[model samples]
Structure formats: structure tokens, C-alpha cells
Target chain A: MTFKKFWVMAYRDLLRNRRRTVITFVAIALGLTLVIFMNGLITGMLDGMLRDTIRLDTGHIQIRAESYEVVKTSLLWRDLIDNADELAARAAAMPEVAAVSPILWASGVLGTASESTSVRVSGIDPASALFDPIREGLRAGEFLSGNGRGQILIGQRLADELGVGVGDRINLAVGNPDGVPQEGQFTIVGLINTGFPGIDNANVFLSLAQAQSITGSGNRASTVRIMLHDINDTDKVVAALQTPGLTVMGWRQLNEFIMTTMETGTAVYSILYAIIFLVVAVIIANTLLMAVFERTREIGILAALGMKGRQIMTMFLFEATILGLIGSLFGIILGAIVVYYFSINGIYFGDLGDVAGSLAFGTSLYTTLVPANLFLMAFWMLVVIVTVSLYPAWYAARLEPIEALHAL
Target chain B: MAAIELEHATKIYTIGEVETRALDGVSLTIEEGEFTALVGPSGSGKTTMLQLMGCLDKPNSGTVKINGQDVTRLNANQRADLRREKIGFIFQFFALVPVLSAYENVELPLLLNGVGAKERKERATALLEAVGLADRMDHRPDQMSGGEQQRVAIARALAPRPLLVLADEPTANLDTANGEQAMDIMARLNKETGTAFIFATHDQRVVAYAQRIVKMRDGRLVDGNANGSAK
Candidate 1:
């Protein structure tokens, strides 16, 4: 039979059983929705993490001391980026490279006249490019004095825990210029909240020179930090710059659990895809099988009228494809609505503190949109519907005209 | 030339432990342009003989031929082609596809044979008009009366312009008036186009329209008369 006639017969068959066709679509829609929702949830989690991580700590990507990879301890002669000043200039000159800052980061102890706390002090350039979330977190006073500072910019959580406000003097204990433990005093200049629970409670920022002085490293930074025009290509920059003794880490590698979870969620989404498609295939197959049985006599009459076996097969397959198309469309629409609603009005648990703490950075999560999921679900079911109709089409084509005509 | 030929044809059916022979040692030949009737009560093998002659079934023991081709050995595909090219069927109960209109039902045979749309429409329109159903061309089978539906069936049977038409109980479901009208149409078509027809029926009125009549009983042809006009 011609393509036109095949389609005509298929459409007629589907219209004859409109209720069954509608139900088949609903099944596809539900399966596709699950796929879209799961996809959104997985993507949303990682995107949220990367946003916060860049805001408070690593600005897209960061350069740390070569030794920082293996031993994250106080620096005592790591493979230094030789001539850090020249390399900083080279990085800053590249069009894709943005501002460059040399920071002296060290883990140390802070004490006041009354109390003390463990602190991670970052020696910063204090004036880098447009709206760094880490910099935005600073709430009071300036980061560094114009003539350099004998001052500290404290995080709000640390200030709250320590009962210190701006203008309070604090003594920072560090290794002195002779590599011996030494003490220095500075006035609190600013207080900030970065929103990263870990950093907000612990970070302190100082001028690069002051930080260098406290760490007893003369005119040398712990590491030179290069900010890029596009953070997405941090790995490419690392590949282009990884020397023999130094290692590079992307923001993703910094937190193993987040990357691993992203992978796990993706893998889980694929399994859900399999289950959803399998359901569509089975439903379509079962429906077509019954449909063929019901139309046996009709098929016989058509055949006796000289309709070819292949035409019969084509008709049934066309019906199956139409079923898939309608189902997938409805599914994508419904699924998108559900995904959108959930993404906008996220589920929250105020008591999720301990639970979130136990999770990777432990917080209750929300879903975001991932377009590929809906498309993927629709494509998956299209294949399923087409494939599932095969045996039934062939079965209808194989019916003996005489026997089927005499069938009651 | 004979339009249908059956030589020692037999059909065996497996019914549990019992084997029922639907056709036993049947042999007959129908000449072109002859309106032949195979008349018998139910289960007397008239329908079986009609099916074999129409190329719808293959015999186990012997040969069956239509329009000089030995169709018993043809595969299902070849058999369908044979039916398309040279044969048409008028069924007992007006087995019109419920979904299609009267015109589409008649258009079906031509469509399957790869006829183009304009020609198919023209042919179907002409045939339905010949069958006195031009005004009801768009009416579906379920929407039409039994006689109107049977007229549509006649138009379908003639659409392909086959030399032979095999009808199994063509008037069995119709009342006498509709049945007689349907027979008159077939007789007129047979006279006009010289299209041979082989009908299997218990209806004596159905037998009246045939030019030759064959009597069947107990899976065998017992007697026959040429120029069928007998009771």
C-alpha cells in the first residue's frame, strides 16, 4: 500500500478507539515527567554548589601552592611558581585572563584580650575585579588601607562566635620572619558574611604584604591566583600551565562528593529512563496486540481486496508512532509544569540543619530545569513505541484471509 | 476459456481427534461469462469450493486454477496479487469496513492495485453510480440500509473489473426484495461486462440469477445444470 493509504488506515484505527489512544498518551506523559523531574533535581544541586563555592572561596578557578595538593599544611618551601610576579603579569595579559592577585593563605590561631579562635587568613590584593562574592561578603570598613593595613577583615560568623565587633583589636599568632611562632596585633576593620557556613565562620582577609609578613615569607606569596575571563575553561588553563612539580585543581575537584554525586545522579537518571521507556513499550505492545485481534476480520476483508501484508504492517506501525507522538507531547508539557512548580516553590525543612550537615555540605535541596531530560524522555519513548509495535504489525500481516474472514 | 478450474481438490481440517474434510475430491471448471451457482445447505462444502476457486485457500491434495493459472501452489503474496489482478469477492453479510464510506470501500481495490487518486475517484464514482448508490457514496456501511450496503458491496466487487467474481452467500442476509434486486444487478453486470460469477448459497432465489447451477451435498458435487433456471 502507498504511504498515504497506510496513514489513512492507521488514523482510522486510532480514531475508532480514541479512549485507548488517550490512555496510551497519558502513560507516556507520566513517564517523561519523572525523567524530566529527576534530571532537574540532579542539575540544580550541582549548579547551586558551584555558585556558592565560587562566591566565597575559589573564584571560578584558583591557583594554590603546588604542595597544597598533597599536604594542605602550613607552607614550608613548596614547589613555588618561580618568579610569581612575571607569571602573574603573563596571566593578566592574556585576553581570556582577568585580574591576578597574589595571596598568602595560611592556617593560624587568632586571640583577643578575652578569647581566641582558629582562623584561616587569606593575604589578598584587596581590590580585584567586579563583584567577587567573597569580596561582597565584607560588610563593614574597607578590605585594606590605601597605605596597606595593620587591620583585619573578619567574617560575620567568626565575629559573632568570638564576641568581637569592628574596631576590636585582636592578636594573630603566626610563624615570624625567622620561622618561629610570633604574635602580632591588629584592629578589626571589617566584618563580612559569605553565606558559606564553613567560610563565614572562619575566614579573615588581609593585605598581601601584611599576610606575607605574618607568614615569615619575605616578598613571596604562598600562591599566585589568576582570575579568568571565562571560569568554564579553568581545566584548559590548568592543562596549558601544569608544570612538572605543580598540580592544578578545578573548583569541581576541590569537593570530591559534589562531583561524585553529580555523576551518581546522572547514572540514576539513565536507569529511570530505561524503566520509563520500558513501561511505554510494554503498554503500546499490549494495546496493539489486542487491537490487532479485534481487527482480524477487517484485516481479512482488506487483504481479500488485495491489500498487501506490508501495508497491513505499515498501518499498525503508523498507529503506534502516532500514539508515541501524542503521548510524548502531553508528557513533556505536564512534566515541564511539574518541574517548574517544584523549582519555583521548593520544598524546605527548617529542621534540616543536622540532616543537611550530614549531607555533602548538608542542606535541604531544590530542583532546577534541565531541558535535555524532557527531550531525552520523548526520544526514548518514540523508539520504544516504534519497536514495540513490530511483532503486532507482523502478526496482523500474517493473518490468513480465509480463516480470518470466517472468524466469529 | 474456463474462468475457474478445480481438479481433485481437497481441504482437510483438524478438529481435535476428528478430521473433518471440508472438500472431498472436488473437481469442476467454470467458463468465462457464466454466472455459476454452487448451492447446498450449511456444511455441505459449497463455501469451501467457492473459497478454493477464488484463490482464498489452497487445496491439500489437488490443483485449483483461476483464469488458467494454477493458484493452489502460489504463496500468500502471489495469491494476493492474483486476487488483486483477476478476482473479486462479494461476501454474504456485506462485510464493509465499518470506518470507511461507501466510496472508500469501492475505492479500496483500486488503491491496493496502485491506482492514482484521480483515477480511483473516477472509477469508484462511476461504479457506485452504476450500482444506484451515487447519492450515498459518502455514507458509511453502518449508516446505510442492508440493501444499500449490499449494493455498495457489488460496486466494490466490480471496481477492479475482474473477469471473475466469487460470492459466498451474496444474498443470505437480505430479505427477498433486496436479495432479488442484488441478483438482478449481478445478472445485468454479467451480461454487460461478461464478468463470470461463482456463487455459493442456500438461497434458491440466489440460484435463479445464475446461468448455470451446481448442486453440492456431503462435501461433493452431486448434480449440475447448464443455463441455470432450475428450482
Candidate 2:
């Protein structure tokens, strides 16, 4: 028989049990919707975390001394990058390089009149692009403006613990970059709150010149941070900046814990989605199997009327294809709507108590719909639906006409 | 050449170590354009004989032929092709595809034969009108009465104009009036189309309409002679 006849026959068979077909269709659509929606939310969350981490903590790439075993802010000048200024200037001249920041760091104690706490003081250039996020996050006083003025920026969390506000005097003590212990009293110029409590609780920022003066490390910083026009260019830029005595690292390696967590989470999410898909496939298979069994007599009539086994099988497969197409179309549309809504109006996790701080990213979780993912999912579900239908189709095709005609 | 010839045909049904013969070494020949009826009570193998003649079953140790071509040696698909090209079938319950209209059901055989749309339409329409159901062309089986559905089945059986048509208890489900009406249509179709028909039935009214009657009892033909005149 022609394919058109087969289609008409298969469609009529589907209409025979309209309620069952509708229920199975809804199962497939809802399964696919959950996959799409969950994948979008997780992708958006991971991408947002990576972007914010690169923005607030690690740049696209960083260069440090080869001898530096651990990344800690210590005032010991032995492991400092002595020619950081020259290196930063050369890197800044590269076309692919966006901005470079030279940072001097010291493990220190920030002391108020009645309290003191251990802290890591990061020294930065106020006007550089690297400090733009923090500059925007200045909640109280102004950021450090010049090279010589004694000023410091403390996180709002740290300031709260120290019971100090803007313009208050705080004393800092650290081992000098020359290997001698030194102390400095500076005015707290600004308070910073970047929403990430991990950074806010223990971080203090000062101008590079003032940090070097207090640490007694002349013309040297601990690291030179590089931001590129695109983070995907990390490998190329890292290769270009491969100096003999300097170690270059990308954000992925620097934030290995976060990256590993994201990967594991994604894998787990996919397995869960696959389980749900499998359940939907089972439902479809069961429905088709029941249909074949119920229509044994009809199949016998067709076979006795001269339909080949292949033709009978084709008819059943065509029915499954139609069902899959309808379910997947609805799935894509509904999933896209939900994803788009979440993308615009993010889900807030702030009420869950420093959720961003724990995750080391923003608190609001948005969803992003990747069109390729939607298409791939639709294709996969269709393949699965048709593949699972083969068993029932084959069963129908192999049925003996005489026996089937006598079946109840 | 005979339209159908069954020589020493045997069919056995087995259920859990119990074997019973349904057709036992029965030999019969049906010529072209013959209106024959295989009449018997239950367990008389009338239905089994019709099934064998329709290419629906293989005889255990005997040969069956249609149009001078041996069908006993053909495999399943080959037999199905032969059935498609050379044989038609009608069932007791008027097994019309419940989803299809009367027209499409009649058009089914021609479609299977790869007939073009224009010819298919003309042939199906003529056959439905011949069966006196032209006005009910678009109605599904449920929308029609038992007699009308059976007439559609008759039109479908004759649509391909096969060398032979096998119908098993074709009017068993119809009332007396509908049964007589169906018999009248089949008899007229046989006369007009010159297509041979062999039906297995116990209904006396149906047996009376057949031009030839062969009676069987307990898996064996009791009367080998054909009464060519209607009773």
C-alpha cells in the first residue's frame, strides 16, 4: 500500500483510543519539558558563577613566580614577581589582552581599639579595569584615589566585626616584603560588599603603592592578573606569555573546585533527565504494545487483504512518529516559555541564607534557553520513541493471519 | 484451468498434545465463475477448507493450486502476494475496517494492487453502486446496517476481480431479510463479474442461493458430487 494510506490508517488507529494517546502525549511532553527547564536553569547558574568568579576573584589568566607553591597573601618578598610592571606593560600592549592588574598582597592583622582580626590585604590600582566591579560595589566612602594618600577599603563584613565605619583609623601589621615585621595605621576610606560573603569577610584592599610601602617591597608585586577580550582565548594568551620563570594559569585551573563541582552536577542532572526520559519511553512502548494486541484481528484482516509484514510494521512506526512529533513540538514551545520567563525574572535564592556566598556566585538563579539543546533533545526523544516502538511493530508484523483472525 | 484445486489436503489443529484433523485428505476442484457453497454443521471443517483455498493456511502433506500455479510450495510472503493478486476474502462478521468509509474499504484491494487514483475511484464507485450502497460511500461501518456492511465487504472482495473469492459464513450475523439481500447481491456480482466464489455456511437460506452445494461431515466430504442447480 502507499505511504499515504498507511498514514491514514495509523491516524485512525490513534483516534480509536483518543484518551490513551492524549495521556501518553502529555507524559512525553512533560518529561521533555522538565529536561529542558532543568538543564537551562543549571546552565545559567553555572555560567553565572563562572562569570562572577572571573570578575571578582580570578581574571581570565594570572602570572606568578614559578617558585610560588601556594597562592597566599604573605609579605615575604622572596617569591614576588620583581618585574611585574614591565610584564604588565608588555601584556597590556597585546591586542587580545583587555586589561592587566598588578597586585601586592600581605597576610596581616587589622586592629581596632577593642578588636583585631586576621585578614588578607590585596593591593590594587584604583583606576584600572580590574577593580571596576569593586568600584561599583563601593557602598560607603570613596575608593582609593591616588598613590600616596594613606587609605584602605575594608569589606562591609570585616568592618562590621571591627566596629569601624568610613574615616576611622585602623592599624595593620605584616611582615615586610624585605622580611622584617612592620606596622601601618591607615584610614578606612570605603566599605565594600560584593554579595559574596567568602570574599567580603576577610578581604581588605589598598593602593599598590601604599601596600608596597608598608610591606617594604620596592617595585615588586605578588602577581600580575590578565583579563582578555574573551575567556576562550585563555590558552592562546597563556602560550604567548609563557616566560621561563613565570607560571601562567587560566581561570578554570585557578577555580578547579568550582569547575569540578559544576561538571559533576551537570553529569548528575543528565542522568536524572535520562531516567525520566526512559520512563516516558516505557509508557509509550506499553501503549503501543497494548494497541497491537488489541488490534490483532484488524491486523489479521489487513494481512489477509494482502498487506506485507513490512507494510504493517511501517504503519505502526508511522503512528509512533506522529505521536513523537506532536509531543516534542509542544515540549519545545512550553519549555521555551518557562525558560524565557526565568531568564527575564530570575529566581531569588537570597532568602535561603547566603546562598551566593556558599556557591561563590550571585544569589539570583536565571535560566538560559540554548536552541541547540532544545533541538538536540527533540531529535533524541523522537529517535527513542521510534526505536522503542519497533518491538510492538515487529510483533504486529509477525502475527499469523489465521491465528490473529481467530483472536478475541 | 480450475480456479482452485485442493488435492488430498490435510490440516491438523494441536492443543497441548491433543491433535484433531480439521481437513482430512479432501480433494476438490472449483471452476471459474462457479457459485459454490461448502455446507456442514460445526466441526465439519467447512471453514478450514475455505481457509486452505484462500491461501491462508498450508496443507500438512498435500498440494493446493490456484490458476494452474502450485501454492503449497510458496513461502509466507510469496503466498501473501499470490493471495493479493489471485484471491479475495469475505468474513462472517463483515470484517470492514471500522475506521474506513465504505468507499475506502472497497478501494483497499485496488490500492494494494497499485491501481492509480482515477481508476481506483471509478472502480470503487462502480462496485459500491453495484452492491447498491453508492449513497453510503462516505459512511463508516458503524454508520451502516449489518446488511450494508456485508455488501461493502462483497464489493471489496470483488474489487480486485480475483480468480477466486472465499467467504466463511458471510451472512451468519445478519437477520433473515438482510441475509437474503446479501445473498442476492453476491449472486448478481458472481453473474456479472464471472468471479468464482466459495462460501462456508450452515444457514439454509444461504445454502439455497448457491448454484452448487458440497456437503461435509467430521472433516471428510460426504458427497463428492456437485449439485449445480439451486435448491
Q: Give a tens-digit lDDT track for model 2, residues B25-62.
A: 98888889989989989999998998888888898978
How many steric overlaps does candidate 2 have? 1
Q: What TM-score does prediction 1 earn?
A: 0.82
Model 1, residue A188: distance off in Å is 11
Write model 1 residue lDDT over A249-270, tens digit each, in one string: 6666665666687788778778
Give the Cα error of residue A204 in candidate 1, in Å. 8.4
For model 2, the DockQ equals 0.56
Name the best candidate (by TM-score).
2
Instruction: Candidate 1: give the clashing pairs.
Output: A29-A331, A356-A362, B211-B228
Question: What local distance difference test score does each model get?
Answer: 0.78, 0.87
Please write out the lDDT profile of model 1 over residues B145-170, one tens digit for every residue: 99999999988998888979989888
Worst 10 residues of 1 chain A by lDDT: A353-362
